[model samples]
Target: MMKEISLEGKTALVTGGASGIGYAIASEMIDAGAEVVIVGRRADKLQEATEKLGDRCRWYQFDVTHVDEYDQLLNQVDEKSPVDILVNNAGINIKKDFFDFRAEEFDRIVETQAKAPFMLSQAVAERMKERKSGNIIFISSLATILGMHEIQAYTVCKSGVKGLARSLARDLGPYGIRVNSLNPGFVYTDMLEKTNLKTPERLKEIEEKTPLKGFTQAKDLGMAAVFLASDAARFITGIDLVVDGGISSSFLI
Candidate 1:
């Protein structure tokens, strides 16, 4: 028999779930038999995604950076059903040289990536704590491991998110809540396609450098999120689940 990874009877709230990695993870959670709530700032995108995801999914439009709104959002969600799985996937990045980053840019990056996840996780964790069980999955990035040129703000926020996961895992483990970070490496999404990695030649560079000989698909990260949220990972916490096709581990000869 296949090892069970079912999330039957569970409810998941995925931030930034209208597109890209967030949508992928939400899809995976639905396939694993969980009810999913997709949270995004774009109402149209959220509506479209919810329709495509079918009956098991719903949408909530909210800007995750607004920390004060978290309680109200959580309360609304809790009324329907308490969130059993919280995916802290909402984030933003501005690629600029360290010297060029303005104070506003720095704050924007930190607010969206670091502060947003921290705030949402804390809000969800409170409900999870009351229930005495929940899963908190954070979406971090390879930037924390590899030194990519520019993107200092992205690097700082991603690193801070990973640290938040570790600290939460330690503090919340005793209460039966599991907190972990999923660090994705070079996943080719629309956002990524718009970046410097757009061209075929640039894509080929990533394939040549990655130990697995290719960049990760969004679904790969999705499936990883499913596993992390499932009971199969019951004993796992405070770990960085790197789903980067071994890119971060390999070095040039």
Candidate 2:
């Protein structure tokens, strides 16, 4: 690859990066010439991902929901290198009707999906403001646009993430930091396999509805993240980058 979107001298921190979409984004960041640190809760998984990603990639085992550890985690990464790009991609989802959802379940999902990003962005943005340069990207979801069934909390969290990015962009733009959210459609990954959409019939329905006629791949999401994090999108901020393969644009009615 030519790496037209070069991040040669940059360092990035991607949360939930042990597998799925996070891992792909980390790989892409490395391809763009940036050193990447992937954060996840599983030590073994993180180790495996790091080995696969090579020397340019590192991994941190931490759960974003542990709000108390946010400072310690940020301190550790900062000691090695001030992260120039922060991807708040850590998230969790529960498949249950709104009425069936327990309060605790909603709280847990929100802590990881919404609260973690808020705190991380606050910390990273403060440091970036001092240096006057940085990129913060959030991994939102298409559910925010077309409400999906049985994952009400997930939908809410993703929607909040987009709002968070817009507000952050307004607050941090003057300090030379850009904030954006990328909302992805149904992407085939381990996580997807665990969801109800894993059934052949459901998968077929999704593909039929998607104008692009296939599930979005992890690499596709990675390339989009790289573009937002690179100089190519320096002028873009507070925008929602939808990588949903035209699903959001379709209307069954």
Candidate 3:
């Protein structure tokens, strides 16, 4: 039997879904028979992605880090689900030396990575609790598992997101809404492209340390998202599903 991942009759809202890992996940969900909504700050990017995704995908424009707009954003999503499967995949990283970090910089990182995920999960959970079923998947990062320098704010926010998932699972489990976290290691996304590490030498460096011997493809994480959100993971919750290709398992540092 071809192992099928069916999300029939479910609604999924994926933030940052215009490109990269989020886009990959949205595509998978669309293939799995779910109605997918892609949310991103850039309307142009979202529209471009929507047009490509056809009828299975829709687009929304909103800043995940904007505190004042979150409630409104959630209201706008209005996913028809006591089963709203939300992929809190939108995030930003602020990399700066400890001494160079500013309050605004720290706030921006925390708001997008930690606060926004929490609020979105909470909003979805409230609806799920009413119907007593839903799934909240958070896209944390492998950065949290290590104390990487320079991006202290990003690392800390991701760590906090994992903690929130664990605690929320405990509180929400009784109501049957599962909450979990997924962390991906060095994926060559646009974010990586923007970094200085996009060189051939840097790619080789990651391959050597990564036990899989190469960086993860965006589609790899997409499969992870599909499984975690599907009924296959029904018995799982409060877990940090690390998709880092064993990079965190060795003494690679």
Tens digit of per-residue lDDT, candidate 2, span 1-253: 3455898989999999989999999999999999999998899999999999999998888988777787888889888898999999888788977788899998888888889999888877878899999999999888888867788888888999899899989999999999999988889887667765767998889889899898889999999999999988989999999998898999940
**lDDT to native, each model:** 0.89, 0.89, 0.83
Taking all chains together, the TM-score of candidate 3 against the true structure is: 0.93
Model 1 weakest 10-residue run by lDDT: 190-199
Ranking by TM-score: 1, 2, 3
Q: lDDT tens digits, residues 72-160, model 1?
A: 89888878888999999987778767898899989988889888898888888988998899999998888888888778888888898
Model 3 agreement with the true structure over 35-149: per-residue lDDT tens digits: 8988889999999999988897777798876656766666666744333699999988766679999998888777788888888777668778888888899988877877665
For every candidate, C-alpha RMSD to the true structure in Å: 1.4, 1.5, 2.0
Give candidate 1's error at residue 78 in angstroms: 1.5
Per-candidate clash tally: 0, 0, 0
